[model samples]
Target: MTILCYHSVDPAWESPLAMRPGEFADHAAWLARHRTVVPLSEAVNRLDRRGRLPRGMAALTFDDGFAGVLEHALPEVQRHRLPTTIFLVAQTLTDEGLDAWWVRTPPPWPLATLTVEEVLHLRDLGVDLQSHSWAHQDLPELDEDRCERDLRQSREFLEDLLHGPVPFLAYPRGLHDDGVRRAARRAGYSHAFALPEGPERVDEYAVPRVGIHRGNNTRTLWVKSQPRYLDARHARRHVARTGRRLLKIG
Candidate 1:
């Protein structure tokens, strides 16, 4: 399934990962007009049942528990009745009050993050909640014990908070290795998501996603959402990577 990954949603924020509310709305409106936006689980079910996603079908996903998603993003998706999955950093979601947890590391603009209560409310509002990581650390850099601990702790915390199975995981920064994937499986995650490096593969534990960033317009979204877009994207990325290697050798 083609899942669109997003981060912060605020008109004022100035980051590639940040998209203004108006632009975000336009993208969703475009999807509602032209394509079918389904929940992550539904797409998976459809893929399993039919061996393919139906034409014009896609899913929405968010990484990091930013408050802007609550303030801006959710209203648009809710208006369209589109299902979305949010992968949250367990430590960033506070039970007390809103804080600067949205800033992964002192971003240029002020950021607000969703609280523990806000996330649960989102789940009640029909958004599926899953693990991003315990502290949003780079999983691949971590070794076996550390990686497994990070994955397991986050899964247990989210499942306990959401009161359901947290079966899916979105890797922090779309980074993972064989060790990380194996850790996720051992932690009880049935599926895992990676950042958009290229097309989505059949790997249940490392399915790639298309990142919908700040500069993307409706046309960009449409093109990226196409079934063969990732195939073409992967080819381009492969060529560039190979060229860089060859240049180094030369």
Candidate 2:
């Protein structure tokens, strides 16, 4: 099974990493055309079922709980009758001033963010809301206590907001060490997502994901779905690392 991860979809440009609204719609349409798009829950449940998923079995997932998800992306997803999972940073669901990192970059664009109310609204729309963290920070970089707070508090807060168990988690910046993964399990998440270099199988703890970045077009997406393509990608990484080491020795 392939789990595709996205950040934001907006008309107004903010970062190169984000997808434009039209581009995102096109990706969704492509999935609808070629694959059996399933809900994260169903995919998890049917992991052991052999040959059940067709050639193009893909699941949609969005991280960072951007407002564009509720504003623009959800409608397109609903139109296609596709299920999506969104991981939210509990602290970002506010209209407060930009965080410190935003100061280092260009002035704040009118980036839409999911407010607490908007999250509730999306839940009503049948979107699965899960925890990203209290603040979008790299868990591996944080101490154990801080990691526990981010994971535990975020899940607790969202569960209270949605009035049920939040079963999924996407690590911020795709950063997780062994300790971070253990922290997530302890925090009550049934599964977690990582930016896998290739396609994913059914694993509750370390589900691999393919990131859809700004440069990803239809051809690139197709290429990424192939297992051989993943093998070649890994091989290229190996070659690059070997060359870097050789140069250092020289």
Candidate 3:
């Protein structure tokens, strides 16, 4: 199954992570035309059972719970009537927008995140809400205790607010290690996501996603939507990591 990841959908913000509304609409329409867009939960279920999705099936996910998603992306999503998921920074629901590393002083636009009201509204609209950690910290950099704490707190906060289970997690920056994955499982997440270049040996915790950036057109997205794209990319990353480790030992 192909899982697509997006960060922000805004016209004014020129960040590569931000795709213009029209472009995102085009992308959404294209997916509606070409692929069987499934809910992330269904896709995860298939992945768990068969370890892959059937051909032409895709899942949509937006990371960080950006306000732009509600403002811009939701209309296109609703128009297409697609099942979508947004992995939110649990703290961002109660606080201001994300405090990210990529933003400069006085960012080009406000790094606005979704509010509690907005999140509840999204949930009501059938958008699946999951954890993106508490502070969007890189999990691999943190020790096991801190990593587990972050994941546990994130899931707990979302569950308390939504009054339901939030069993999925997407690692911040798509970064994780064995310890981090173990923490995710310990924190009660049934599945977790990482980027294309994340670890090989795929399982629920190491599930890979193709990121949708501003530069991705229909053709690029088509390439990404291919079922084997992530597997090939993961294999290459695994090889490179292994080679570097060997060189260091040699």
Q: Which candidate gets the maximum lDDT versus the true structure?
A: 3
Tens-place lDDT digits, model 2, residues 1-250: 4677887776665554467788878888888887788888776665433212235677788887777777778878988888899988877764462342321222256555687888888888888888877887778888877798789988888888899888888887666777888888888889887774422333566666667766578777777655345446556766675354321000
Q: Write the per-residue lDDT of candidate 3 for residues 45-160, one digit (tens) a residue.
A: 76643246788889999988888999999999999999999999887776554555433222465578888999999999999999999988778889999999999999999999
- Give the range where candidate 1 is weakest over 10 consecutive residues by summed lDDT: 241-250
Clashing pairs in 1: none
lDDT of 2: 0.71
What candidate 2 gets wrong by more than 4 Å, as runs, is 46-54, 94-110, 197-203, 227-229, 242-250
How well does candidate 2 score on lDDT at residue 246? 26
Which tens-of-lDDT digit does each residue in 1-250 have in candidate 1?
3678888788777777788888899998998888888988877665532123667888889888788899999999999888899888887754543344435434665677787778889989999898888887778789988999988988998888888999899888887778888999998898888875633445778776778888899999988888777768778877686454321000
Q: 211 in model 3: Cα distance from truth in Å?
A: 0.7
Please provide TM-scores, in order, for all candidate models, with all chains considered together: 0.89, 0.84, 0.89
Each model's number of backbone clashes? Answer: 0, 0, 1
